[model samples]
Target: MDPAVRMVFKNMTTDLAEQYPALVEPAKLILKKCNGLPLAIVTIGGFLADQPTKTAAEWRKLNEHISVELDMNPKFEVIKTVLMKSYDGLPYYLKSCFLYMSIFPEDRNVSRRRLAYRWIAEGYARDKATADRYFMELVERSMILPTQQSVCSIQGFDSCQLHDLIRDISIAESMEENLVFRLEEGCSSNTHGAVRHLAISSNWEGDERELESTVELSRIRSLTVFGKWKPFYISDKMRFLRVLDLEGTEGLRNHHLEHIGELLHLRFLSLRGCHEIFYLPDSVGNLRQLETLDIKGTGIAMLPRTTIKLSKLCYLHAGSGSGDNEKTYFSKCEDICEMQRDLCVGCCSLDLSDLDGFGRCEAFHLVCCLMYPNIIRGIEDSGVKVPRGTRKLKALRTLRYVHLAWGIAIIKEIKGLTGLQKLGVVGINKKNGPGFCSAISSLSHLESLSVRSGDGLNGCLDGMYTAPENLQSLKLSGSLEKLPEWIKGLQNLVKLRLELSKLSGNLETMQVLGKLQNLSILGLWDDGFKIDVLRFQTGLFRRLMVLDLFYSRMEIKLVEFEEESMPNLELLTLSLGDTEIAFSGLELLQSIKEVRLSVHSYLFGTPKSSKNGGNEKMGKTLYEMMKREEERNKPMQDKVRQELQAQLDRNKNRPVLKVQ
Candidate 1:
């Protein structure tokens, strides 16, 4: 056996005795089978540690067969054992965290702090101290592994991740525990009793029995059932219900859904993706607590006018619909969309004229819709025009997707909206149009700007990159001939995305880009880059960590570069176009951690066969870096542990003199 394997085995045997003092002999037998594999030893030991009783012989035989017969590495087995033990030992709070990982695709890295906060919001971590403390402890105990992270401690402790094996285990355990409600084909009704959250897919055809069984699941708080089942009656027994997501219901009839309004606690309701739900009950407006109402892709073309009664609604995704019924228009939604007093009826081309009746408004929008009855009449009565100049929306702050004929009049009006922080618009004209660059150049508070240039973002190309110094994201979509030359200036911008742009300039742009220092994510797509004609150094993008280039080409100039040049690069995606020379420079990206390549089948690639050596070395380096980071953070962990221990000790030592 390899010496490394032997050393690993010794470490496990010693740890097992300490954890399970009573089951020493059986523990040794388990270790022998594990062959010093930390995974199996920890898993089996942890499981046995949680169990109150287990015979030595019984433990020994199971260990022998699993370790030797299966030829399993003991270390891997220990991981499994510990995971099972931790899962079984978890209180409801941690179990929820473990199960929720299933929501992400396999191998996905979940942020620890984000997960903690989600748990907090879900009421699982109501007591922040307990939740945060245990969250770190779980990671330390090897129940979850910390993923590649920007900081050693996020909020507190490092971001965490679960191994694919452990994640699978969690999923299996969650299903068995009835924590997950997966309503799939051939699903038996027997499992319905224990399910607390149910997700029904599109193929879930329900008969009367299934419907009754569903109703019986009254304890469920979150339900996402797909498919258009018959509009059967639903009872108000769903008292604990919080989220009801039924999308793509293609065959729902006139549902006797009157009682659903009784669920005052419901927070999220989704009727989108439903093809046949024609009418909404007026009682739906009674859900004052509703926060999100998504009815975008439903057969119900118009909404019940009472929907505005749901004053608490925050997110409403009401897209275009076609029907003869009157639609519900919210003074609130209208305000958010920057629509003044009148509703722009897209189909009728009628503008709502009763603008003065709108009690108060903050913002307005009329994207690609010119309607009659003049909705702007109400705003005009209140001394507000279609914001035709760069005017500060002093009373308003967020303006998103306001469409106007790409003209100077609208541009000047937009400048008046100085208070605007989020602004998105499309250029209707394909030719020349006045750009918004000079107008919004001084809007120092602008954080997000998304614009569609005329003839592929051509009119706005020169001044596209100018914005507030604090701007975090700049997204330019639609047709464009090349990457804007001005993009090199926005040093503060962290995220930049260019869509449908066939860019030709190279090297100089790449060099300038490498100097941005703060650039973390760069995605260039829509036709390939003219790499051969470009004279840029690959090593110039030193600070870039994530590079996504679809249908992009690059010329290799450097043969060898230090690993630290692009030290932070972790994710790389490059399309393998009809070029083999481009991959020669891939090695220059020494910090590459994960590479996703879409290579043509016929493109012979040497990286596939030979470049693995560098990847292996890179993996080792990353692992060493992580271990060092962990060691560096040891003191902090110790400090927290000590604090907790002292608190526990003080409580134990406190004087509690019994009274007679």
Candidate 2:
């Protein structure tokens, strides 16, 4: 074995002994079988560390079984052991969700929002929050590796993927349990016993025989079809079905949903990405047990007027995608070009006045107007409006993108939503600003709030005396002449995005924001702020991990960090906007892991003038200067890199952070 592999093995063995001293011998045996494969060893070790009982006898048994399986399947010995052990260790609640991953296509990112809702609808968990916990557990165990989990951590969109080995094992185990029946192109379902859940993949085109003759359709509990198929009248026979996910089905006209009321047990229905579903039947109101109704990215402009009957519904997604942008792992579903005009719910005159039955709903998400204000004007001009009576949803927790026409009545109703944890809306004007400010203060449970003000957010903040104590994430986009007085009170704020703020003066508000101990990410976009000389005070922003001020090149010219300021900051982004950096006491702070500078202007001919002064220009960003004279950005960039590198080398533990 290579020296590197040997060192890793030795280090891993020592860690295992520390974690489970009693099972060290069995761990050694497992590691021997792994042959220094780090993934298996680390995964298995983590798994054992979480075990309820760490008896040596039980581990010896597991070790012996793994060794025997390795000999039998020499091709994929280590991975099989790790996967099988992981599956066996899962609690009963997570077992089903683990198996359900096999339903998605190979190498596809499983949507966190989509899957969590499915689990809630399928009665796998009590509610959406419970289902989310199950997902977090899987992620913690490494069974599901989330794509860009950190990118959207603040936004709450956690999508993930299953490794191929884990995927295959899930598929095989699902078949053995008779929990899922995957219908392939020429394959027929086994009618030997009752198969409860069935899925038709995109590549499969099974004939009618595969559904009617092979399996008893009435016994099916879940039917998920991701293919080109006509399931127009199939709901009549699947009376016992609880979940009908037709997200990718085509040509689904009103006839498809006409008889949907017959399935009394149906709880979850998905029409996302369905191009042919122009209209829905009134029978949709009959699913009193339904928990989730996903019509996102579909051609359905209007829902059945009797939608109030679904009193049990908790999650309703009516938007193609939200405006709260974050780079996720999954690709957006292919658009149905034929129904493009009428498909988006935002562009239509959707009068959402009669959804009073959504009183029990926890999450009510609609594309109120994540679109630009100009696009919204062109779309919602013809009387499309989000009506009043949302206060009726006392149980509501997440209400997003509501185009509140801005009045006393609307603001009063909003104040009644005391249980709200997350909310997003296109705000009202000055006439209703007082009421809106009062309402914002009343909702004490708000953890995440996103407001896109049509008439400037300053009006809404005018009367605000206090911020939500628990508010952690906030996104505000609009004109801002002054900082909100309530902002300093939000000590729990973790992520904040302030857009289009023309801030200036003594930088008092910036200092207040810097003192927030829990702040993790801060983004200042176009027209954010203008300060001549920005200085960081020591002992401020101690818990910040990502500080993103890299915007509007030339807007900020000079910045200096005092020692002990931002001691834990891992990522710092600065827009070289018309200004250069002056590092003060930078050598004292050695915890910085990365520094990103977006330089838009710097003169090469005058290096001394560039450092001693500020010169705004347009040219190639990264270019080399004469070898003896100086590098293109020798005054700032090259020197800064060299100093940081020296600090990192002296620390020994900190690796050289990538500078871009």
Candidate 3:
């Protein structure tokens, strides 16, 4: 049992026993059946306690409802009954927020602020006044328990979690009530299917027969299908649909999407992982009101010819993936890459071909295919001329994964795109000059800047480009052999990540990063060798909250440091490299509420006392102590410890150390 759960149930049980004496015994039995499940205890227990009638008939009806409504999932029937009873007791306004959670995926953790935001988005609550009040009301009633311990200072709610079982139950009830839909099983419904809003899984292959049944989908307004589905034809009957989500269904062949142009009213069409869907029929230009089109995984080998006509299209994820199935279209930028509207080219090599027809684009991601020469040829063949002044890209704000191979050419051409706010790219070429770096540093609104590492090329980042002043988050990975001095200039950086390194993190770089006042999450992985100086400099990270250091080669003992340095730190991870590292003070990391220690170090000395030894009882007691430490979150820790101590006392007269 989780310690948090034990505390919650113990208090709730005691309160119910005093207030609702009649159902207290039965409630205890039900809570025991829950096995300390938090969601069940809070939601169901709260509902049951508020019931106006505890008569035999009402209780029987509740149990019957559980047996029937929760028949498919018997494992959590008790929990479902608890929630059903509680839901019946809820006021009309609170019920709305609780039911709205079904909109999120099952077992997903939701923050109170985000949930409130979504409620506002859905117009469920008129304003923050009603939404916030309802959220607090739920917390006060103990219907939605807070997942975190309130530290008096933390304002508002940070995060909340529903028991996985309860989440599933909520989703089931919501799906039945038509609030949401999750197509886990095979799609058996025809166009006349009763489902209002649909979220289908394309991860599992559907029968071709499913398409035949989709002919009457005219009434369906919104549809979300997983991107992994093999290219399948969309029925012409889906004319009434407004939103079509094909996220992660990369297998949509050109012919499979022929009917998309017919849905003229379609406002949002997401092809997030449609990497293989290389061609969009010119018919797509007919969607005059199409607001968003996401083709995140569409790795265009070259530009397409017909995209130039999409006047109202605001978003597109037309980028390639790193796989054999990767697909790219060949066309000019004016004709393909840069339509008459905004295009979101995710992970696709940017080919500034056919720039003549270019229009103002809101955003573009150049993180794909950093290999320059091949992409350049594709751009040239498209006949899109790159003028000295590319005015159309001026409004762009975010750029990511731009390959450094074409860094010089692109920077020179797209210098007019001065509105960038977030940028992620690699700098490996000697030709990457101060002007290119300056061009990047000019974007004042830039909040997140990530640099690609130069692994095989050491000393490549000696004095890299100076970062923009507004940069708040910086992530470095994949062969960043050394830290450059220019990083210190980005004083506003709040979150930093250094992953997959080769003997990096020297003292100079650490000292510069340690001074950043707003730094929050810091993740470092030094697989090659240990640099212990950074570990002791915990005080330098004054405002750091979360720290993760993995697979280090350091020789220091992890248990020596006290937690007083990280006053605001909440989570800490220490991966030990040597057996001499003691974990005695691990429980004393004052500020740290949660700690994860990996025991990779080898255990030294002969067996303390194997089961084959004379002091068998002593060996068992020690084994129990080790097990308790391994399962640290056990709710009955005190009782378990006392039991082990008694066993140890009984074995005190035996040999303390006996050879196997």
Tens digits of per-residue lDDT, candidate 1, 573-646, equal 54433333323233444445555444332222222223588887766666666566546545544443343334
Give the per-residue lDDT digits (tens) of candidate 2, residues 594-620. Answer: 556544433324332233222322122
What TM-score does model 1 achieve against the real structure?
0.50
Output the better candidate (1/2) by TM-score: 2
- Scored by lDDT, model 1 comes in at 0.52
lDDT of 1 at 122: 47
TM-score of 2: 0.67
Predicted structure 3, TM vs. truth: 0.56
Candidate 2, pairs of clashing residues: 553-577, 554-577, 554-578, 557-579
Q: Rate the local accuracy (lDDT) of all candidates.
A: 0.52, 0.63, 0.52
lDDT of 3 by residue, 514-545 (tens): 77888877777545554443432556777877
Candidate 2 vs candidate 3, lDDT winner? 2
